[model samples]
Target: MSESLTIVGIAGSLRAQSYNRQLLAAAGELLPNDVRFILADISNVPLYNEDLESALPEAVVTLKQTVESADGVIFATPEYNGSIPGVLKNVIDWLTRPRGQSSLNGKPAGIIGGTTGMFGAVNAQMHLRHILPLLNMYVIPQPLVLISQIQNKLDAAGHLTDETSQKFLQQHLDRLVSVARRMKNEQ
Candidate 1:
């Protein structure tokens, strides 16, 4: 087995009880021993501004450094009107600053999300699938974790109680680990 991989997980919602946040918490429980999952704080990251690029906010700088140092990233997004939330996109914009020299460039990423809607956050994830590549991120292709009706799937402690969700999350993490390792090797 290869060495442990450090993954930074970003939850897109700022709600106190966001399903996406709970989903990421559950993912941490399912991760393998050889993986370390760290949740990035996007709540404090201000809106992206080109004028502030040269003097980025402390939060943005910390977020960028964390992502740049990680072996992989996991985006837990919340859909709004069949699209990704603006805050999530804003964070990505910050990471993509300095144009072709984005911190996310060439990084491996896994997209997952939860919602009460029947289709889950598929629309949001699809948007990210297209967008991450533009920032030069290599996203995992299989085992997409579009957790639908998430309110019933998680417990009071934010643990994913559904068996199917657990299985899919495990599969997604497995692929992320393999892909991250492969990308690191090629780097």
Candidate 2:
């Protein structure tokens, strides 16, 4: 690994006070202090289009570069209806185009999510798990972090106040980082 291990965290929500964004922040805090954790900004990426393929937007270019340089990614997706949010899916679409030039290709990835619903974004996470491979990412299978009825678990400041949720999130991050380390070493 290039002297330091790096992980990029992407929250699937655009809302400033989004629970998913808080979840991503918690993941960042749970990680080892030495790890270089980045909260990826997806706010500026325009919608994907074939017509715009030849001239990729600056935000897309930066997003791709961020993911392409990282050892692993953590996606904190919020469920919409019974599926992943369109914004998250839109970001994935932007990363996956131009044929074989995807920044996410073969990158180690982990999914974490929370929702006000009872299912804790499980359905959305399942959908996202299925979609990762399409972007050529390898989803980490163990220690899944799914937060259902997330409001009860977070404090006003957005930190996870529930022990159970914190434990699960920590375990998931540990596993993700371990896998990332292995991948980086192999490179």
Candidate lDDT (C-alpha), each:
0.90, 0.89
| Candidate 2 residue pairs that clash | none
Question: Which 10 residues in a row give candidate 1 its minimum summed lDDT?
Answer: 97-106
lDDT of 1 by residue, 1-187 (tens): 6877889999989899999988988887778878888989888898888998778899998999999999999999989999999999999999988666588988899999989988879999999999998878889998889889999999998999999988999999889888898888887
- Name the best candidate (by lDDT): 1
The clash count for each model shown is 0, 0
Measured against the true structure, the TM-scores of the candidates, in listed sequence, are: 0.96, 0.96
> On residues 102-123, what C-alpha lDDT tens digit does candidate 2 reach at each position?
8898888989999997888999
Error of 1 at 111 (Å): 0.6
RMSD to true structure for each model, in Å: 1.1, 1.5
Model 2: ten consecutive residues of lowest lDDT: 1-10
